[model samples]
Target: MHPLRLLVVTLLIVTVNLLFPGAAHASPAVQYTNPIAAQRADPHIFRHTDGYFYFTATAPEYDRIVLRRATTIQGLATAPETVIWRRHASGEMGAHIWAPEIHFINGKWYVYFAAGRADDVWRIRMYVLESSSANPLTGAWTERGRITTPWDTFSLDATTFAVNGVRYLLWAQQEPGIATNSNLYIARMGANPWTITGATTRLTVPALAWETRGYKVAEGPSVLQRNGRLFLTYSASATDANYCLGLLTAAATANPLQAGSWTKSPNPVFATNATTSQYGPGHNSFTVSEDGQSDLLVYHDRSYRDISGDPLNDPNRRTRVQKVYYRADGTPDFGIPIPDGLTPARLISYDTPGAAVRHWDFRARLETNVTPLADSQFRLVAGLSGSGTVSLESTNYPGYYLRHRNHEAWVQQRDGTTLFNADASFIRRTGLTGSGTISLESANFPGYFLRHRAGQVWVEQNDGSATFRNNASFTLE
Candidate 1:
């Protein structure tokens, strides 16, 4: 291989060894379901060092700033929520309460949100609320006034992160001279969490064809640090189905204040995955799995496409979470927004690294680059037969599940029979092959294990050979 190619391959191998299989088991990722929270747009999930995933978002009513906390990502779905603050009756913080994000800064909790005047609902501006108590829900909050920018234009969706001990704020704003509805900007902080210092740097605008649909917009900024680079993501277009995500990348070593350091991707990264029936997926925040190893994408979208009247008047946009994978080059491969019902994953075999367990034409086997994509994906749901077992339900097939009939693995629809439940269930255990993988044992046939032979899947008795371990062991993706 070329020298550079060799280096890239080495890095990829190291990353795969470090991030997958082992990190996969740290969280019960399958327990999650889509639409984690309903009528919550511009959602933000912050995994604080307190071992809690703090959540806040734009309420469908556009009225109050609310918060929820849970130890695990899925727990947030039903965790008790508290209204930390509400909109004022008049003046600056009176109307259009939107996109609230909670952050722990300088031993205190701070919330950044956008608000408008009661009389002028569209006159939105970024505002702050501070709490000295560690538990933000029960703590008393004080209004910290507005985050004043160079020019007093419409600004919202404020997010902040610290790199090299320097804290910087990234937000969406309408510049006085700019023709676009909004542009992304970044600036270092002065003394407190609510203030910005120095000249602001414009990072991205609505220049692409897709970004200009419905509205000339570039907003909802979020940043993820990985692969020795800063990946800044922003939402664009109107709030309707046209809204999508765009990315801006810059080297970690460069001066971020210099506009030349960042490069904007010509196309959107994650958008409305029609195959998944998820529409207008945008305004995302990044958080890690409970293990602090696997990165997770947090965002919101509607289950349906069309709206009755104004899209903003519709309240179905809901919060969702999914795993984030990386390419060999170390960039994030967001893939697509998964379909609703339950969280989906691909069972990747250890031996066939390029392929995953997929069902094609009702035949369960390993395949690479499967089309419709959903054919290769499945949900690991609670066993239909009993507790302490798992059933792999086909992502696209829905009611159908991967089952063993005459020891052969196949995707078959449930007939509502006791035998069908047992045939579809399997007990997950430590890899029969080795570490960084999992083994599924037949729930009905005690000694039988799901393995691959000649690229075909089968539930067979383990012979205690290295080949059996290699064939039976698979990693959750």
Candidate 2:
């Protein structure tokens, strides 16, 4: 072979490797930190096909409907909100605008919200606005008039979803003959989302002790369909600390209009967590992560247990979001309302595939095929010493940091210990394969990188091999 030809071939190989390293590997799993927006309630986020997440929530004042959109979930926190519509100055929709949900249907945008009259704040009724613009934030939203019910009574929290080629509307309302303040109801939606075509059927009433706590309520209904079933979740009890989420399940093939077809969970599927200090967690909507890989639960909760005035007027029910998992039986597991802060994320091992970095009894180890929660999650925080490095703080252990002692990783309290300063900090670098994966190189030990060896974490120098690169690389999800 000619030397010139061999040299040309070598140069081409190097250039290709440099330009697209690790391109053969699958893309990393997407992860997001939560509390996407603060002080916003009845959160609704939907990922559109145009690769953006559109978010809308009840404003603290409950006086207007606002909309925001971002390419990423974390970006929604800083996205500028646009006031698309405001309450009427008088008559119906004059005050108390709540639980506004935006949906794109039939090449147009429709917003479903509940409003009440200025004179009678408790006379809440459902209303909608329509916009022909592609971008809901920039278009005109014309009122479509009030959605009148059979009986003049209280109703709110209207949500719409389609199954088996039919669209249905689910909401909570007060039946004239029913003693409870509100009960869950559903009906087939007409061509206009604001109106229902058929008779409304009572699905579930607030009859359980938990549901009847402060107020006999079953409002704020949201829908999630999976595993051949439709899961309808609603907020129950008062809007105070006792507020929680209740679930109603029905087979996807069954008639949703039939009240007996749905089975209500005997207990609240999601509720307040005293350990996390999150109270009154309810009124949740679901969306997929930016990469369209994971399901996310978007909801509102009070950071503190106590509120000074009426819970509805407290204005502290901030909007939060977290990843939602599923049970073995194909049921959605909301887990618990995570505490306010950076939500937990996992470190996926590149070499071992499904393995992840997990802590057992304060010692970091590689756990194979384990669920990424609690011990497996770590808050990737900025380095303590302003070095542009990163520190891994345990989600479950709180103040503990992942520190290397004698080249092995261990979770230890910060406490200003000498070892915690540089040992716990790492400089994040591109994976050896040059993929989106990350390699945490020890800030103190320079060439040494964090890697799992024999199911244990160790700081070791790179051996410049594919095996070594795979061992040292981790997907920061």
Candidate 3:
């Protein structure tokens, strides 16, 4: 072969390899093994600068600020737990620190959490603690001071977000003028962390049915952004199983400071199990997993049955997580309550195999030169070889993306025939006739196989199944 021919063949082989790197990987939604972690609630998860996940939650029985770090969600549970801050004396700073949040701003680390006087749980106010190191685990935290505002009333659940280089703080409070329960408020940050630039603008009050469930409240705000829109997701209703999630959104072109600028969703975005034992599903924070695929929603919910409707009495509000999704429009559609045993969608990884007929939530890897399909009928391109983890998705399916290995992997399309591509144009559907030679990709491993008649594409050991019909229009598994 000529030198140019050799280069073309080599490039084709590499393109195919990249297209279907993992042909025999796990199903994206395979249930994650539990207990991912134990006894955590009001989870505050943040992806650290160092590519690790840092998590904090409400320590129900203790007065200390707890922190956990891990490379993966499952690893977080086993990662050693650290108590960074504890209550001080008998005064407002001495007791009942709740919903602690850690943030890295400027050149140092700051922890924002609400604490109350030892004797009174209602005196809860948000305070800040500082650390010097970039890596939080190695730093020593110094008490910065209580974040103050214009009002002297009770407040808690303080959170901050920076928009277009402007910093803003939000919290729940009972202003002197408002007679109802705690409402949500937002304000601009001043020169120092302690100062407020202007009067706090009231963002929301109890209006929706979910917001008025137990105490007519709306608090615990966490923000999500997409397509130049800002979404403020907050917990509402009583903390019992009735606890739910609500949204407030505004366009990037709108004034974030104007109270009317943010539009409230008429219905709750996420909620608790009306039939199941899960209760009070609120107080959530969002984070992206290591692979940067989907948004993860981290909140606390009661695993056990709730005898009382009151949010305060429930002791089992443990931390839980589920994948957050978006609708056809830019708005979010936080689907039904995900069960505790439900596994999170897998992040696309290099070693994963991606082949499957269903194309269920698997994604493919893309490079500039890779060609997916010859035509809609499914033809292979000689310039491309199904070499690496093949990332491909079905056109008609929303949640389906599959990656599989090349040699041992097979795909059964809607016609129910085992298939593989040739030259990106022709289709050749084969039959295993039995389950002996199949494998399915998984969250932690490559591929596992079962009965062939079970209707799932299986892979051989260490094989990836991420190939598809068309390269140009295809998405990887």
Candidate 4:
């Protein structure tokens, strides 16, 4: 009974049986929102105008150059990463670098990329990389070489646009008597950054039929400009479900600098619907969060399918996200293709409510509803299961329950800030009364409720209680 206390009680019973093995096992709620960014892949998000949101991806062991920065997008999966650039030994900065976007332009900070020769990943071309700082997390990038353009066969993704003040760039080449596998080109940019001035065009090819799936690949282009028009969405075939997403346009009045005047889109404005495990969702990039309302849709999927039987050697791809809609004639609609556990469309905070303040946001689904894998932390979704204390917005914090069966999910943040817990689970008790009343919904109208009757309020339910709307006001801090 004393061999170092029996080796510390046999290593605390083998660390509680390797962290609780058969205690009827109930320790699984720790998902900020579901696999936010693990294994990176072709992700590319950028909010930066100084407010932060930088994501970048495709480093899959190309030897470094990660980046994360978050103020929100759910704090970019626990942000705080930075690996700028790496792997350079001789000349064109050494070997196979791929993807790498990051733009800010005209005032500094550019990043367009694609590398080659580590025994050639097809001699991937294109480059750019600069930084004049405004806080690219403390600036100083400098590496503006090789942009040349015009042809030179096997090119890479590259993107950029400016219009009216001129500045083009769009890429994806192989024009010399093409054999397939590369098309999307464009030109413009020249004021240094390795020149280009003009003559490139070619625009779209893979020639519809879902752009020739799995290899006649058109290549990621991405450029938008609504109202007066100029879209250009690109990326097709070869990535998986034959990879997808296509659309092209031009007609702010004509001369879309010729490619025979834009206008493609015989189909494929985004695809993949193998019931919804989401195969090759294409390389996309478009933003609008930070409360500007919505419009996300980052891209990259494949939760399960062949995985290794090919989808280009599926690493389960990862990075899938949603939210992007608009159609009546304004074009750009992205519907029907959800199903990966569906629940990512509640980002509407307007800084208004008060009276005792209670806020709610949910989309976290599962039951085969899909949308659950987007993690950052604080997850406990089960209809809201957990301990007691069920209420908030009573004048500040009295009796604000959400105790979550004891694991934790208590919130109090300010105004005497004290109830801070995280791993929650309650699944029941959401009330306002009888058959229904546990409200705090928004899309602006219908069924909204925040009724606390003193110091913090937002009520809009009707059929009872003075038809409340108290003209906006909410604060519980």
Candidate 5:
């Protein structure tokens, strides 16, 4: 290329970036710290058309419905919350105000939540509150009264979504004849947004042994439509360490009103990951990022395992969020609950294409179908050695960092030694093979680069091999 043409192209790129922010650097919404809001359980976040994310959840006090708004998902962590509605002194909606989901439907905002009577606190029922104001924080919330189900039994966790231009309501309720505590049901909400006007279909029951731990239950339904299918997820079992998420999938072209159309996964998709120290991770809601490209999983989980007395009394079930990844077959691979702290990213190998840098038996390697997905996630943070470089920290194991021991790249715990620091630190360089890729050059070993050989990752100086450039470079996904 000519010198003048190269200079003109560089100037054009800079001008375009200056005129439009994020025009050159398009980073998706994948980086967000965990425990987004402390003590906010059964979290539900909705990204509305107003370019604001609306968040609501079960307050620790279990006595009021609250809402908050922010432009970015991470901004909601410190956003001021407003008490939209409180529990009644007595009678209907008197206590146990839980799992409030805010949604904008047909130009009106509606909040769906559960409450119990003051006289009998266990008399849990579903209810709705509506608002006409553009901003939900300033509107008058008119009570829409109780949503009458098939039986006047235990019911809660009501969620609503539209499928193929038709709206439907999904919730958990106890069937009159069923022995389980509650079962999931769904029906169409035709003209009225608050009423179920069509045939009610039973989606799941507590038939599996895992679903009957502390109590036989299945609740908290959330749906995501993608890849020509409607993927529905729900919480199951007791709200203890046994609490987990189960999946049910149905084709988008099939009738959602029929029980035969949906197929439920035999096992739990997302559950308690003791390794990550997240327990009873359940009752999740799905939302997209500001770019509307990445799907974010918003749920609640406790950092500890032990809960004295009833799990309901525990106040440490904090709200959290993480990006959901997809498999080659177009299905979601939820993996497990990511440990606390920095948001992690996958290191996709440029040479192997789809294979990612993952840890196996404490050693780093580039591989596909990595189990417990956190093994493939690494947080590139400010260098433990110094600020001039970066250190790759393991997501599942918080204190551990990826460092070279005898030229072998391994995910090991930080030893607080100068040698460990220098070995772990690397200078992120532009891709040696192509654009949009990165090569990590060892800070201590100078010319040596982090490369993959025979599937294993190692910090080795270039051997003048044909695959040297391709092996050392990777694309962060």
Candidate 6:
């Protein structure tokens, strides 16, 4: 070939390499850190078709409805919030604005919230706000008026969902004949969301001992539909440490307005786990992850169990989120609320697809079968600087981190030792698969990579073989 032709080919190759560097290496897995927004309770996050997640929750003051949107769930944490609506100074909707949920329906955005009148603070009722704009965060929200119930009584936590081409509204209210503070009810909604068309049916009351712990309350209902079943989860007890979640299940084809169609779980489905130091883990909403592969539970909880006076006055109930797992029986397994901090994740070995990297007796090893909660979870934190490095902190053992000493990985306690910091941090890199896989290179050892050999983890130099590449790659879940 002529020299001019050779030069042209080399230039083209260089241009292609520069334009698509990722084609030569694996892309980093998408990961998100949680507690998306702090000091915000009753979080309702909905991912719209516009590729943004709109978040709205009850402000701590309980005087206004605030909203924020972001391209990613974690981005909502720092996104500027807009006060869409505020409580009136006197008449109805004058006080106690709570649990505002944003929904897009029939080309309009609707916000359903619970509010009370200034004269009667305890007389809580549900109301709706409508926005015609595509983006709810920037639009003008007009009052759609109150959602009146059959009996004039306390009603709140209004949530709406459509199944089989029919929309239904589910909420908690104080029934006239029932002695309990509130009960779960459902009614078919009319053309407008603020109006209910059919007869209301009481689904569940605070009859169980667990549901009536502090206050005979059954409120804050949220829905999750899967596997031919409709799961309606609601908060029970009081809004303190006794606060928990209860489940009411019905078939997808069953008539939602019929009280006989639903079966209430005898016990609370999700409750406070003292082991995780999370109290009052209730008022949950569900959303799918950005990738559309994982379902997340968005809720609020207090880090501490003790509150100053009334739990209602406590401002520590902050918004949090976690992955929701499903059981083989087609039911949701809302395990315990994980401890607060950064989001916890699992490390899956690429060599053996389903195998996970776990710590047992402070030693890191590849376990084909591992327990879900403690052993396999780690909080991946950015290392010392923004140098594309990371440190793995054990979820169960607070300050302990994954460190390599003498070429083997072990869970070591971080005791302000210089060697510990140097050994614990690993430089994150693209995986061998060239997409959504992660490879950790030892920060201190430079060229060495974290790998599993004979089920034990070790730091070794890459051999550029299929086995070595597979051993070094991991999926951050």
* lDDT (0 to 1) per candidate: 0.87, 0.84, 0.61, 0.56, 0.89, 0.84
Q: lDDT: which candidate is best?
A: 5
Candidates 1 and 5 compared: the better one by TM-score is: 5
Query: lDDT tens string, model 2, 259-309?
Result: 889999999988887766889999989888877667788999988888887
Residues 1-477 of candidate 4 have per-residue lDDT tens digits of: 889999997886566446433211212111124346766666788787778788887766665567778877767877888888775775564776767788887677787778875555567788878888787756778787677776666888787877777777888877778778788888777776447786777877787677785578788787767768877787787776667788888876666558988988788877776644566677877765675545576767665545456454444566656665444366666653444432333211112111122233321111111122121112112322224322221111222323322221234332332222221212122332221212333222244443333322333343444224222211111
Flag regions of model 4 displaced more than 4 Å. 1-35, 44-59, 63-94, 100-115, 119-123, 126-155, 158-169, 172-221, 224-228, 231-254, 258-295, 299-412, 415-438, 441-448, 451-466, 469-477
* Winner on TM-score (1 vs 6): 1
Model 3 per-residue lDDT tens digits across residues 1-477? 999999998886577457654433222332233335566667898887787889888887648898888988767878899888788868777776788887777877778888888887678788988888777776788887888877877787888888888888888887788765778999998885555688789999987777887687888899887768998999888777678888999886676789989989888877766443456678888887567766777888876645555456445667776666444365665655544553333222222233223332232322221121110111111211233322232322212233234422233332322332221111112112111122222222322321122333333333223222121111222
Provide the clash count, candidate 5: 0
Task: Pick the TM-score winner.
Answer: 5
What's the CA error at residue 155 for candidate 5, in Å? 1.0
Weakest 10 consecutive residues of candidate 5 by summed lDDT: 20-29
Measured by C-alpha RMSD in angstroms, how accurate is candidate 2? 4.9
Alpha-carbon RMSD, each predicted model? 6.9, 4.9, 10.6, 20.7, 4.3, 6.1
- The order of the candidates by TM-score, greatest first, is 5, 1, 2, 6, 3, 4
What TM-score does candidate 1 reach?
Answer: 0.84
How many Å off is the CA of 327 in candidate 5? 1.1
Q: Cα lDDT for residue 289, model 6?
A: 84
What lDDT tens digits, residue by residue, belong to model 5 across residues 32-150? 88889999999999999889999999998999999999999999999999999999999999999989999899899999999999999899999999999999998999999888777
Could you tell me every candidate's TM-score relative to the true structure? 0.84, 0.83, 0.69, 0.31, 0.92, 0.82
Worst 10 residues of 2 by lDDT: 20-29
* Candidate 4: residue 348 Cα off by (Å): 7.4
Candidate 6 lDDT, 117-178, residue by residue in tens = 99888889999999999777788989999998898899999999999999999999998888
Scanning candidate 3 in windows of ten residues, the lowest lDDT window is: 374-383
Candidate 5 similarity to native, TM-score = 0.92
